[model samples]
Target: MMHEPIKGNPLPSRAQAYKTVAVIGAGSWGTALAATLARAGVSTRIWGRDESVIEEINAHHTSEKFLPDVTLPDNLMGVRELSGALAGAEAALIVVPSRSIRSVARQVAEYAPDGMPVAICAKGIEAETGYLMTQVAEEELGNRPVGCVSGPTFAREAALGHLTAATVAFTFSQADRLKPHESPAVRLAVSLSTESFRAYVSDDLVGVEIGGAVKNVIAIACGMMTGAGFAENTRAALITRGLDELKALAEALGGRRETVTGLSGVGDLTLTCSSTTSRNMALGMQLGQGIPRDNCFDGKPVVVEGEVNAKSVTDLARRLNVDMPICETVRAILHDGKGVGDGFAQLWARPIEAEPRAMDLSFDHPASDKDIATLAERIS
Candidate 1:
């Protein structure tokens, strides 16, 4: 489905939303988003299995382990029980690790209010099933409305209330859209946005999810370049070529190519690849510095999603017959026991070709200016 603009009532003021939201993880990203919602006057509850973390959040209003030095809002609380978190939530955001998405979503489907919109904030392909985050959500969450929230967000910066914009992709069922009810997509966008956090709504769920998943693998490659003391030009080339790989895979999976050029695709890719704060990039950096894979994430509390996603994406590309050399190289370095240097050598050994059109190319004839204008009008 195409990403049509959200059409419905103009959202009420932030103070008037009066929403209570459930965030299904107490990790850095989940906590940060919970804080954002609470600061926007929405009552927010974060769920976690760790009692100590829940206690710290409720009593001290801080997540010292994941987001140290960040103060949470008064209205943001933490719950040890998932049921307690979902009891009165108008919506739920699944922010757990990508690998745990299916399990968490099943629990949410069991407890969350009927018809509650669930926003998937996690970003990775399931290593075991190769399912995108949204696909997993759909399989486990049943008929619940599903959306994806992703972009160039750093948890610390977002918690600090720095201006951040993210792509929010949701689609209404045809039956729901034909009814007299307001657009759930619009409502989700309004409920999730804060003064400093903006959401650009889209209907390209596949593109949004693919962008969020594949960028991590590319970030690992970029980090390897950085750790190997490569110049900025090399990093820039990787970023560009990495985007090409992303576009190709996303399109092959039935996603719109233009969606990849949006916030969830190039935007997230640039952020993850350019920063040491990205856990995936950091993992790659450690590998480049001669650290073994087992020891790379030794003291880190957070999961390095790219390490697992590297193998998943490579598998997916192979299944789809998509060319993703960067992701393949990442998979080799992380999973195939290939040395970082050797992986780079393999990538450099590939033959060159003209840049392939990553968008849909089923047209049989060239288009005139009038045809181009008509196409633009239709898309616009």
Candidate 2:
């Protein structure tokens, strides 16, 4: 069921005023979001490079290549011309591949209306520059408000109108500018939320983006465990420990630790790791089943973001001096041709330490010293 905005707390005139949105990229994720906005009664245009995909979406209200068996909203149109997609768009969503973010942002910069808000829906660190999706957008968009929308969202489920939640992280300034008669942040939040899709606003852009990116790598590790015949106990251990690594990297990158504990963090991690529907997990499953990397993704149009993210995350972790054993192991297996058995053996060979390493809790907590002592005693 779609959630109605709080009854008495109606949105201001301007907050409820947006009429159209442009979605760049015609992949499953992009199409799903476009369908969502169109269902919300907003005119949505999706830009795709392929003429066939555009024709399929326009003529049949479906993108069979990316989102099969799903009927899109009639209000949703697909455009082959980038300029046409952005011509009258009130806001834009960039849903391209991580590496293509810069080029797409440059196009939006040239074609989009001045000062239009852009939300990045892609999640990954740039392999060459280590830039997060929003960072790349800001660099190329030049003063345009760039935010991020991320969580544990599967395109198929979202397109089917299943309940979904996502975090929208934007700067205070961006939030302020987006506001009309009320709180800008709240107004921006209202603009994005739909009956079935809920948007939570946060200022921790780095944490949200990091969680979305790094969880794919961890999901691959969990898939490897599944393929190796490890039980749920092993998967549980990886999820817990992987979260610790996620928190460490988020903090090192100047994000609040609590952000990793939210929807975009543990929520996304759990979904991706536990589901074979995840492209990354499926790719890892192939590797675990002894399939070569080249053969793993044969004839697939969707990108398995984790395969590239493994290298990027490991590189970022090293640059920040954060310990990420699992991510590093994934990097070795994917990029260095390390055997799966050897990778797990290497991880098991490492010396044991405190469950939550002391360094992992470097961030100051709100608990009183007495509270900490009580918690410690309970654990002991």
Candidate 3:
């Protein structure tokens, strides 16, 4: 049942939509998604291990622990038991932190009804395996159709009914893979989209997920620059170069370059790097303000994804032979305990190169006076 307003655009009717969607986390993102889904008229149930948060959502339609200022939808139900959340749900959206996703996926595998489509909304590479979130979901939830929901979304803003867009990417040929059945991508996308929340569908699942993961790491670098009093030009340079790195990594991982230029790529990158509301960027700001790594967290209760993404992104880049200096430098500062100033210095000291469509040209431009002098000193 496709609702085609135009020849190419297909929309799903209310009768075709999934009646119940199980949101597998109670954190900010999860709550926001649950609220959005409920507002869109879908029956949504949010699951969390914290019984208190569940009670709060059920009784007051608020999630103070995560979204302190926002009130959730009245119809959005909260459940503590995994089985109860998944009992009659047609889809499950995993919004837990990446570190805990595998465990959650394991639970879903055991509890979720067979053939329910799973969408991963969290954005980060798995630290232990360096696998993308979609890959992790696919591995853990064997034979199930997997998809990704990611973009430049902030939980608070989206919860406030602000205009937002995201990429809804499912694996290509999913119907064929499922064999003798309909693919959930279109139905899921239509069901998730609303007046304020728009969903752009694609098949480049890897590229979309890559943009979500790498942008967090880049946002940290941009935050550090801001914290250190760097001007806008420096931030722009970093953002542009970060795009190059993202494209390189995406291509290496078999994703399309155009995907890196889409909403999930440049759009998400710009929003994350420019805003302090992002947890990763905020963490970078603290580090850039000369705060010790140990003291950066102080009182924040959030899991800053960039902290873990730095290591996983850099490791994956190295394994794929992709050049991502900004991400590498972030990993050094965050994991190697390298000083921020020194890291920036090393980044600025690298030789300049020409840009191309692929940005892969390795030829260095004319050597700087400093380089020439250093070379001369070595020769002498």
Candidate 4:
């Protein structure tokens, strides 16, 4: 849900706002953001390692490699060097893959100005450390104000200048400590918002990030059902049940269940699960259609995050003793060599049970200090 307008100091005018914004990662998502920011009149620079992509974006104002046929704004610059992207930029958006977040953030720390606000646009749990994208950013960019942007956004649609709404959750812990308009979330939201792209601000950073990360795994399950030619009602039931699992896991991680129903959770889940545009869903669909697991990524260029996230999300759920059968099943199929058909059968074979009560989904014990500290740490 979009947040109510909070009373505080007014935001700076666009003319007075940050003039230039750096968007790290020139993939589809990153390119889309750079285009949006440039269209919004913010001089935007997108950084990537792809020589052809950089040339296309700079010479032709297009990212043909990722966002084919979409014309980018003339003001949007593409840079091959990290320093060229971050140098003198007021804010940065890290849109790299989940696994590369820590490395990208480390580079940003070395190049970006001190105290520059950075927004994490990646969605996945770190397979090695089980850290959210924002957590990885925070640890690496220690002095930077880290935030997260998530929702049901598709790179292609957004790049095409289609309407899009997203949640921007900041790291602020106390609403009473800072005025609403003065908050990091609000500032970043303003920096990214445009007429076509709307950003809703929230303080529930953990909830927002958790919702985005776990939903991809669920999307895979939904895709499998679709590939198997299941009925609409069956898919709907899976989505609803999958949401309960998401809520339980979020609550266990010191996040709110309500966030599960918000944009990052149900909203993202709906968009990802129902469409072939989502790489995760497409992967699941292929598996459901009897494609060999080993041949799934035969020619894919980019990483399908759900394949990696399935294991990480399930592992985290297990550590917290959270029941996430759907996600676990996905993890098994994707990682443990479990057949897709067998996985689906196991899910259906489970005994029917009563739907969980609201209280059942709620966290029984509050998040302890130790738990919070552990969450902050990166496992070696």
Query: How do all models score by TM-score?
Result: 0.87, 0.87, 0.90, 0.88
Regions more than 4 Å wrong, model 3: 1-15, 174-182, 299-301, 357-380
Residues 239-332 of candidate 3 have per-residue lDDT tens digits of 9999999999999988988889999999999999998888888888888887776677786566888889999999999998888999999999
Worst lDDT 10-window in candidate 2: 177-186
lDDT of 2: 0.83
The TM-score, computed over Cα atoms with residue i paired to residue i, of candidate 3 is: 0.90
| Clash numbers, per candidate | 0, 2, 0, 0
What is the C-alpha lDDT profile of model 2 across 186-237, one tens digit per residue?
Answer: 4446665788988787877899999999999999988887776676997898
RMSD to the native, candidate 3?
4.9
User: Which lDDT values do the candidates have, in the order given?
Assistant: 0.82, 0.83, 0.85, 0.82
Q: Find the 10 residues in a row with the least total lDDT in model 3.
A: 174-183
Error (Å) of candidate 1 at residue 317 is 1.0
lDDT score at residue 258, model 2, on the 0-100 scale: 83
Q: Tens digit of lDDT per residue, candidate 4, span 1-380? A: 34444467554433234678999999999999888888888889999988788998889998777888998898888898999999999889999899899988998999999988899999988877878889888999988889888999999899898999899888674552345666667766776788899988777888899888888999899887787777688679888988888888888888877777899989998899888899888888888877776677675564788889899999888889888889988988888987776676666655555585543343234555465344323110
Report the lDDT tens digits of candidate 1 across residue range 87-197: 988888899888888988988888988878899999888877778898899899887888889999999999998999888788756653443134555555666678899
Alpha carbon lDDT at 276, candidate 1: 89
Name the TM-score of candidate 2. Answer: 0.87
In model 3, what are the clashing residue pairs, if there are any?
A: none
Best candidate (score: lDDT)? 3
After superposing candidate 4 on the true structure, give the runs of residues whose Cα lies further than 4 Å from its correct spot.
1-16, 173-177, 358-380
